[model samples]
Target chain A: MERLLAVRCPGLIEEDESGGVLRAFDRVVAAVEASCPWVTVVRTGICTLPIRGPARYFGGEHAVVDLVTAAAVEAVEAAAEAVEGGSSVEAVEVGIAEGTFAAVLAARTGTIVEPGGTTAFLAPFPLAVLGERDLADVLARLGITTLGAFAALPERHVLGRFGATGVACHAVATGRSGNLPGLADPGAGRRLHALRHPPPPPDRQPGFWGGASEADARAAQVLTRVQGLLGPDGVLTARLQGGRSPAERARDVPWSARSRAGRSGGTGSQPPWPGAIPPPAPLLVHRDRPAAELVGLDGTAVAVSGRGVLSGEPARLSVAGGPWERIAAWAGPWPTEERWWTRGHRRTARLQVVTAGTARLLVVERGSWQVEATYG
Target chain B: MFDSVAPGRVPGRVPGRTAAPASTTPGGRRDPSALAALDDLARRIRPTAASGTRLLPVHPALAPLLPEPGLRRGSAITVTAAPGLEGTLAVAMALVATASTGGSWCAVVGIADLGAVAVDGIGVDLERLAIVPRPGPHWAEAVAELVDGVDVVVVHPPFAPRPAAARRLVARARERQSVLVIVPGRAGWPEPPDVRLTVESSHWEGIERGAGHLRRRRLLVTGGGRRAAGRMRRCELWLPGEDAGPGVAGVAGVAGVAGVAGVAGVAGTSGASEPA
Candidate 1:
């Protein structure tokens, strides 16, 4: 999760008929930009900036908070002076937390929640803070009032009961995901651009080689229809992140959200993991790992020792207790140890075993074997 | 650069432009310069290299197994493996990799456990690829919708489809000019496709008795279909062949290439009417 700082102006939030409030908000943005170069406009009067780098440069989070608050207050005062009969500017609110959604709520009360404490801090807040009226009303009727109570529901159950948007809200409530689709206004930046520059006369001819290609537009149309048919989570796109195993390395992100962010797709630079298996990666990574057994020539169950060494050479393999096939060739016991100090620590070893015409990746942990993936 | 000057804003247009003399001499000789300029204009206004009626490009290695030029648009191709072989999914991914990377949109439906790394390794641009892991009962509807817009639609029906449903999808693909690549795993496709690619036999190399890593595998792919693609062609490929460039049959890992020498080189033969 990204640590972000949010700035909210209560006075200039609602726009007046004269556009004076927006101009005042723009002044506030300019003032904040002087201190942090990456200030992003979340909406008309709301903005956010990342705090990690600035916090380091300014000595600590506390010092950066103070600096940002001072800058925002000065800007509001200047804007208040410029507009005579406009909405009177009030004290600027600034706070820092992990993710823009939580940071915005933190800014409302000028509270800087500690890092890794976002879930606990957000626990007692009412469902209204989630900004979903119908969902909050329904959840309230079921006696789930607080965000923490709603977060306690199993993720699959939440997804089944409330659909994709509900699952997104549930993820935010649980601190598992930082982004909620409706939290950031997609057109806020374009709105600001329109304000900064008066429009030129509309051109008659279309620009050469501009906009999305015809194929992209058509694909977007059909994908949107698919989303409508099977809900937002049904249509997904894969994003590759750095991890040890194939499952951990790639995850399915909702296609609608991915497209809205306007990110040019491709795997970005990922940190090299030391123990990850080399890449002529398996074509099929089994989601439900079927149980398998690997036995030696003597029919004794083969296992991996504490030193990551195999007890015996595997000679036969059976998946889900199906008919056993001769293991013509095999390799590995790539051991991985995760979170050793925690109670949830796990140690497993993986092997590549081939049968007549099929090859599979097998993992053994605590003297049991399961098929992890298949080379096919 | 010339386009930067908007047409409406350009000055000095002759009022009698439509009434101008033809670019030909009195003796009916053509003006070479004017003809060249017209040809340049036509070329500039043509559709992009990847679009229009042009065939979708295939990977250099797999090109020999398909029709003369490349994969035909509005055609259906079924990729199936022999009863015990497991390289059908690998073969299917190889078939679509080139078209997907050429800026065409491809979607995979009903493939729940798709390995993204392997797909990326096969060179399919992830940006243009969409996946509907489980469409459930809306399988046909979802596939039909995608076929309308996507350049390629690959589906594995969770259940056996009614013959009518299969035929309708084939018709839709033809109408939309999209390629349909079906992997029909357990629930088989009822209608025959234009090109049917079967993985005859496959064997892993470079590993024995737990000594070395799983380097690569050699697959025997035989292409057979109806009409234009009826001729049977056999191709021996080293999928994810040594060196990480996926699905290049005879390229890279020269030592491993000779491992399948006895698989009968039938690529150039009049390969037709071989028993299925």
Candidate 2:
């Protein structure tokens, strides 16, 4: 069976209609992209990705799930802490099952249907879940409220009488999409597009909330005065509780106590950031700059050129005609080749070099060489 | 600038025609109980910052130049130096080392030339450190984002500070309960820092010639701000003081606040004289 994972950010519906919330969500999306690629965004609050390959690569199904969930939470927490009222938006739900619809519903309903059990799991849900008002009303009149009871109807009559949407609802009610073959090939970029017209601007989405509520504004006031009485360092902090959804994980305690809180409760992950945390994370990292081209002592471009060869002994490098520097020591010509199986493949070789006056540089040679970071 | 402004005064407004405080309405009659209740509510609302923060560690040898030996959370502090990059940075790094080791996150912003080797030499935990070399025009917003997540935010704010941005960032820091350590940049903070320390004189002595590298620094650090109008104190010391058996709490009598100020050496130093 095809393996699918659903990710949900609950409580996304309720927060101020503000851009900060969307930016925070964007970080969560970036975090997801860091771990898995085959993702189809369900909506602002939900998304799904094919996880069979990653599950096998990273130990097992449970391990990859845990890794992705922890990473998503950490990123979401960091991004949320950047905005007002964003402190409590951290619980993220993950549900795994057979198809997109069932997996998302499982995430929303907080269910983790076991493998191959999609039928039995989705069978007992209420008819309102179908979200088809007219069809649901017709089914209700026929005394069919439970999905299992509705799915038991004759398929031909349901198709003949109620039409295609009714048949689709029946397919969803019974938890089966007959058209899609259970290919199980994760590398198959079959349905989900790599990118689509950018998601409607976060505010343009339905149910946008912007201004702060009276309660939040009131909380800010209470927090200020209590700190005055107790001293700025005397604030209280909330503990992380295991929640069904991401936002709910940051337990919503009363504001009086929360008012005395410290800078978010620290991302609070045991291992903190894992594989993705760049080594050392240089305390003096410069912002992304235009790629600096590296040239050899002979003055030719120092890269794995068109003929696929390291141009020459690496020596001089310059940033957009700014200045040139000498390379003192070096290592690595590690190659990264990806998606060769698909039409748009990518390949690049990276070099780690130390400059003469003591500066570490990570240079990637992709048709041309560009400096990525400095270490010394 | 914000601290000196009157409570109800809005910028550019005529003094006599200022807006009324939250407790008053158009009728113009002041309600005593309402005013008293407002005060109580105001008192109830001040949020506590870094409730769990303990005293950030300093070298045991230099502890007398501060009004409070312990760094307080939700406070803005300023440190000024006399030009040399290493000397000024040494003082800043020494102060950050203690807080970072204590498990708090610290970030340094806008001082683009800072190097990793220098920070490492000062003994700060690089794991807990974050650096933003160029914040561009949205410098205030960048620092505010970091303020919400980290315990200590050290910034040499970009460009001349504006009152509006300054007030907003300061308020954000207060809400998050984090400390904002402003290293006065090309343009200083729009608002005055709560605690300010200036390096009076910094002398590097260990490097004799081209043969040796810098090892010991004799620093004269003086501190004075809102906390000290008359009691401004000075300290002299080796910035990365030796990690010895115990830090001195000192016998207080000379400056009463000998145990409080942050200039480091009031107990005694090898070269320079210090303030009590």
Top of the candidates by TM-score: 1
Work out the iRMS of candidate 2: 24.0
Q: Could you give candidate 1's per-residue lDDT for residues A1-376 as a string of tens digits?
A: 6778988776665444455666787888878877764566775567888798788889998898888888887888888866545334645778787877788767765779999999997788877666566677789899998889999989898888899979999998898775665555433443443454332234522222645665677788889989998998899898766678878767888887336311233333234567877666777789999999999999999999989999999999999999999999998889998667899999999998999989888999899999988987
Interface RMSD of each: 22.6, 24.0
Candidate 1 regions exceeding 4 Å error are A1-211, A257-272, B1-52, B250-276
Best candidate (score: DockQ): 1
Superposed model 2: Cα runs more than 4 Å off: A1-376, B1-36, B39-63, B83-86, B227-230, B242-276
User: Can you write out model 2's per-residue Cα lDDT over A1-376, one digit (the tens) per residue?
Assistant: 3557777665332222233544565566668867764454444445667677678778777777787788778877887676565434667777787776677556555556788898787677766555455676788899998778988998997899789978887887777751121111121111111121122233342222734333233334533443443344322232233321112222222224223222233422212221121122222333343477777778877666544357677777666676776765555454555455888876656555544332333445456555544432
Model 2 per-residue lDDT tens digits across residues B1-276: 011112211222111100112333323234577557545543332222123333454544434555567566556777777553324445565566666655566767666644443354344544445555556665665676566556677788768877656755665565445678787775666787767777665443222311232223455666666745236766655543322111232222322333332333332211111010
Docking class of 2: incorrect
